[model samples]
Target: MATLVAGANAALTAENPGLDHVVVGMGWDTIPSNGPQAELVPFALMCDASGEAVSNDHLVFFNQLVSADASMTFVGDGDQEQIDVQLGLVPAEVTKIIFLAYVDPEFRGQGTFASVRSAHIRVATAENRELVRFNLGTDHLDSVTAMIFGELYRHRDDWKFRALGQGYSTGLAGVAKDFGIAL
Candidate 1:
């Protein structure tokens, strides 16, 4: 059974029995009349205790599918994107993973989340059991070119997920910069 949660600060632990991995899935529909089709690219940053990316190698996306320690991976493409995390594989130096979606810059000038019929970010198990989900819909400001959907962070010796739902007009680059990525 999955827990439905809301707000940026809401948190939940991945304490389900036999759970060793969590998949962060993002999905969206394109609005036919919204100029050229846009891609909602999903990515994640492995951050340390201070919320800064540990290194460029920790940026997982289409071009870079896996993290340095094999703890994180970006899978799938197009309207549906996913990030897989191995709870036990993450390095102790790392403390958080921020899951986000961005409107490809190539399509940003003409499209935005407003053109998305519906979108959502979900956390689930390897066996396909949903743990939690957050809807990122047209209600968002049209100027938002990127979104920080949620985050998985360490709380004590356990892992927890927080619903972020924050928007960014600077797109993916902005997010990368905010997380301490050089470029």
Candidate 2:
């Protein structure tokens, strides 16, 4: 069973201490709408110790699935997305990896997170043993277009996961800006 984390900033270590690879999975159901089709896209932003993206290569999404070092790669599609991270391969300068769920532009133009149902993010070992999970639908907000679900950061020489549960009304652009991405 996975450990359930209740709030933001809650930290949990991966299931197997010896594991070097972990998967961050996010899933959501699209609520029926009269407008364009609803799609939830998951992405990751790799940041340095200053919480700023090291480069454009650090932003992994549908178009750019893998990071520069191949430490992180986005997997799956549609309502579900998974990110595979090779902790040992991540660069020493990279200090944090943030996972996010965004309402695709077509869908965001018509609705917000309120149109997403049963949204959740989970972290697990390479073998599929879940370590921690956070449900992003607990407090759905119509004004928000994206969610900063959680983050994996370097703690001493080890990595730790933190449930952020933060919402952004400015869409992906806002998130990109916050992480030092030019566009």
lDDT of each: 0.77, 0.79
lDDT of 2 by residue, 54-136 (tens): 99988788889898889998765432888989999999989999998777887436467876778788887777778778886
Estimate candidate 2's alpha-carbon lDDT, on a 0 to 1 scale: 0.79
Candidate 1: segments with Cα more than 4 A from true spot: 3-5, 8-14, 34-37, 76-79, 107-110
Residue-by-residue lDDT tens digits, candidate 1, 60-156: 8878899988998876543288888998999998998888888886753545666766677788777667878777546755788788888888888
RMSD of each: 2.5, 2.4
Clashing pairs in 1: none
| Model 2: colliding residue pairs | none
lDDT score, residue 120, model 2?
81
- Give TM-scores for every candidate, taking all chains together and pairing residue i with residue i: 0.87, 0.89
User: Where's the lowest-lDDT run of ten residues in candidate 2?
Assistant: 6-15
